[model samples]
Target chain A: MAQIRMETNLLGANDMLAAKNRRIFKARGLLVINLMSSPGSGKTTLLEKTIEALRGRIELGVIEGDLYTDQDAMRIENKGVEVVQINTEGTCHLDAGMIEKAWSRLEHLPIQLLFIENVGNLVCPAEFDLGEDIRVVVLSTTEGHDKVLKYPLVFQQAQVVVLNKIDLLPYTDFDLNAFNRDLQLVNPQIRVFQLSGRTGEGLAQWTEWLVEEVGKRVI
Target chain B: MHEMSLIAEMMNMVRESAAHNNITRISRIKLVVGKLTMAMPHSLRFAFHTMARDGLFQGTELLIEEREVAYQCCQCGEKYLPDMPYGQLCPNCGSKASHLLSGRELFVEYYEGDSGKGEENGANTHGN
Candidate 1:
């Protein structure tokens, strides 16, 4: 019997592709954001609000990932932005390879900010790196405050957390203090913003931060 | 749920290595997964059994080693293992300026196989 030794990373192939994508984005000076959330977290609504806020200032594009429908892509397109849709069939997460394919279709568009809206899955999407400049997780007030602790990996991996549906905060039982404490425990460096997509409240801060990020990424 | 895809990737790597080493029948395969990776061992085992049913992987023993989460304080420069997944704060200085030391690892360590020379039941020394 031969004892062969091989130390290999399971996500090596995906990571390599992600690195390549990162290089391409850097060369083009594009600020890419991977937006993730649960199914009912209102990621699409947040994108709409963000586009409305930063419409004339920044040129933005979107790559929407979903299981079957292209509804989110249509919504972004209606906002007068270049949008591409990737159907992962039944896959829970969009891998780096998928991002590469989607980017190829939208690369010709002259856009400064590119948002890759990932599939609605807190668990699986956290594992795949899409070579984005920033990772943002959308958590709504209706999703309960325990989400940050229950799905710690996603929150820990995210650089920013957008607390959407803030207009309905009074109606929900979400504990803001517990949410902040849990977030601090999981990821101390994470920046958080509380906003409402429907009412357009607190959207300025988020959009301002995004514009600043785009400027910083300019090569 | 994603463990199936993770195992699929592992099998791809194992297939390449087996072809390179001329290993026909695999006897044991070892995997190292960190606790923070969120890849459950039981799910991985189930995936291995379902996907690795070919003749080349017949009766292959799958072993998984779980590594605990460890963190290092950026301010104090102290490394320590955490008791919980949410333990990113330093226990010594009570500071949140800390980074992960381990725990997000998912890799294939090694595999023991035969060259199909009727080496079955040779020693049983690798039984763990």
Candidate 2:
């Protein structure tokens, strides 16, 4: 009985820290997005294309979370945007404390849009809150249509779902209508976009929606 | 995996609680995980069993309580749990304005432990 009370108190502490981080982000008037997807789902590719599309419009900064290496961070930096790499040292997801540390390195940058690319895992990353304005999940058609159903938590928690690699839909047996139906079943209100990062087809709608969302936050 | 880290966090919480309460051993642990968390109960149990070894909760039994997703309709101000996945329309008022109220929590609710052993009969009690 007493032990349970104490455990509750401990989680309370962590939740309080999460709330504090959220409050800080809200005060800054910055739009923070926690981007999550499976490995090789074109997360970095989509990000690159987004940067190119919205570069002049939005002042963007990125915080890349990975198990090891600064490869993703380097990729984002090559786009001439401010980026921070947080190597989790084998940890699967980025928690509030890790984001807090990364924020210190990015606090000085004149950033309006902050994107945190979470480690490539569908399950664990959805569990942690990193003080983001939205939680966006990316799914590539090459990964199969069953992804949304298999990992319902990510889709359920996400505010937006980006279906990348649509160019390969003809080569693969990926079903767009079925995928959208499953996504709607899990999260009806979630905004989903179908696009091919390689061909730059169907990306404009997503970027335009993102620009509008950022605009609303900026004003 | 992230389950390992979460188990480590759970162990720390158990240890801190046992120490604070001056309890020696944790007999059982109770945790509530929301369905939306999507944590595999088996995986979490496996992780906890492996990580809890040689710790304060060496022989503790982890009891996990699962909760379903519930939402409150923002328009009609009605609270209800949806059975179908992605059913945004309220059953009563047919309002699409609904917001998630719970089902994302992952926390250790409490633990049970024996305080001390009795002198003669060796029965568990609050103190020796």
Candidate 3:
């Protein structure tokens, strides 16, 4: 029997493409954000609010990843932003390769802030890095506070968390203290913005932070 | 599950290596998976079996080495192992500035296979 030593990463190909994407974004001075969440976490609504708040101020573009339909992409496009849709068919996550293919179509557009709305999956999407400047996870109050502990990887890797559906916080049993404590344990440095997409409450803070990020990335 | 895709990538790597070294009928494959990867070993094993049904990977045994989440406290400069991904706070100094050192490993370490010229009955034909 012959033993062949091949110590290599399983996601080496994906990581390499991610590095390439990072380089491209850096050269273009584009602030890329990978938005992740569960299916019903109000990610699309958050994007729509962000677009309304930052439109004409920052050149914004979006790449929407969905399982089959381009519903989210149409929503973003209706907000007057150039949106590209990538239907992964049945894949749960958007890898670097998919992002690369999507970005090629949007590279010519005047985009300074690019948001890649990843497939609404907390697990698989966290494993594949799409070479974004920031990783944001949107968690709704309806999703429960235990999500941080149940899916620690997604929270641990995220730089920011948008606590969406805050207007419904009074209606649900989502404990804010427990959520903050769990998130603190998982990611101590994570910045969180509590906002409701339906009512547009507490959205200025989120959009302001995004504008600041885009400003910092601009040359 | 995404484990199927992970196994498919592993098979691609194994096939390339086998072609390069002229290995046939791979018998053993070793993998290192970290706890922070969130990839369950049982699921990975099931994926391997389902994907390796035929071809050069048929009848292969998979060996997995699971690694715990390791972190280093940035403030106190102390190394520690967290029981869970959320338990990353430094125990010695109660600091939250913990940097993950080695917990996200997911890789194929090595594999053992038989060359067509080697002994068929597990006899040591090549020098160890």
Candidate 4:
């Protein structure tokens, strides 16, 4: 081809489509939060707990992004909320275009707060914003304190940081103090919640926070 | 990893630009990537060769230039590259930095190849 001078971003299309998705959610007054983390970071477990606690408090829907299985979507569906599953096959991350397609599928459904559980990857998922009002990342205590420093982008972009699996802290060498210190160095404005999904500890805090966030969207 | 998807998207954009500029074929492609992305160059090259061999321009030489990690220290108003990747503390005054000045870029700077003479498929000019 002719040597042409072109300056185009790799994620330009995804970003534009994400803006459109955000507009649609905003127009419909739906507060959207994107949940991100590495595989097996207790994201779905936290979602299950949140759905159980806030089931009657707010209308909800979940868009689950998985590599091959619809298991996470099934979990949300069983909790009595609208759920949509997006199987990325082998894609490491979820982009805005995929979110737009999933949103279109749930347009007729009654959803006040949308939780988009992004593909389980700390690196790529954080690079692309899926029109989320807030981006929260879940880090389990088993993943250790070095993870925040290792994967700084995802932690830094997080509006809320959920440190899950705190019940197993006695078994692991995860230093919570160092985690908080590094988290502050990375993002001082981040809202941190240390919770255990299995034992039901600190679930009310997230549930209350979710209710308030959804309420803010209405006004 | 996802470099294949990235390459596919990038080539589509290149094809569109090629069509608009009346380029007959591309030989060399130059890209500027940021170190912060942590994308392996070998994987990127493998992705490019696997997909580009049959589509658009075949046997195109890919050149990648990695940008250094650079950022501005929000607290001390000093700018410097940290010793470690994904470092949050500023070495200057030990303050948390904000603005990222470079090293997150993923874009094609330009390409070099022969273009179809505007008067049809006739002449070839030295493209740099």
TM-scores of chain B alone in all candidate structures, in the order given: 0.88, 0.80, 0.86, 0.85
Instruction: List where candidate 4 sits over 4 angstroms from the true fold.
Output: B116-128
Q: RMSD in angstroms, all models?
A: 3.0, 4.1, 2.8, 2.8
* Candidate with more favorable, higher DockQ: 1 or 4: 1
Pick by lDDT: 2 or 3, better one:
3
Each candidate's interface RMSD: 5.3, 6.4, 4.7, 5.3
Give the poorly placed runs of model 2, Cα more than 4 Å off: A1-14, B67-105, B116-128
Candidate 3's residue-wise lDDT over B28-70, tens digit each?
Answer: 9999998888888999999898878765888899999998888
lDDT of 2 by residue, A26-116 (tens): 8887889999999999999999999999988989999999999999889999999999899988988888888888889888887888899
Better of 1 and 2 by lDDT: 1
Across A1-219, the per-residue lDDT of candidate 3 in tens digits comes to: 777777899999899999999999999999999999999999999999899998779999899999999888899988889999999888888999999999999999989999999999888899898899999999999999999999999998999999999999999999999999988889988999999999999999999998889889888
Evaluate candidate 1 and give its CAPRI docking class based on DockQ: acceptable
Could you estimate the TM-score for every candidate? Answer: 0.93, 0.84, 0.93, 0.93
* Per-residue lDDT of candidate 1, residues B1-128 (tens digit): 77887999999888888778767999898999988888999999999999998977999999999988888999899888865555677888888888888888898888888878665534332321
Backbone collision tally, model 3: 0
**Local accuracy of candidate 2 as per-residue lDDT tens digits, B22-105:** 667678878887777776678889998888877467778989888888888888888888766535557888776788777777
Where does the lowest 10-residue lDDT sum fall in candidate 3 chain A? Answer: A1-10
Could you give the CAPRI-style class of model 3?
acceptable
* Interface RMSD in angstroms for candidate 1: 5.3
Winner by TM-score between candidate 2 and candidate 1: 1
lDDT of 3: 0.89
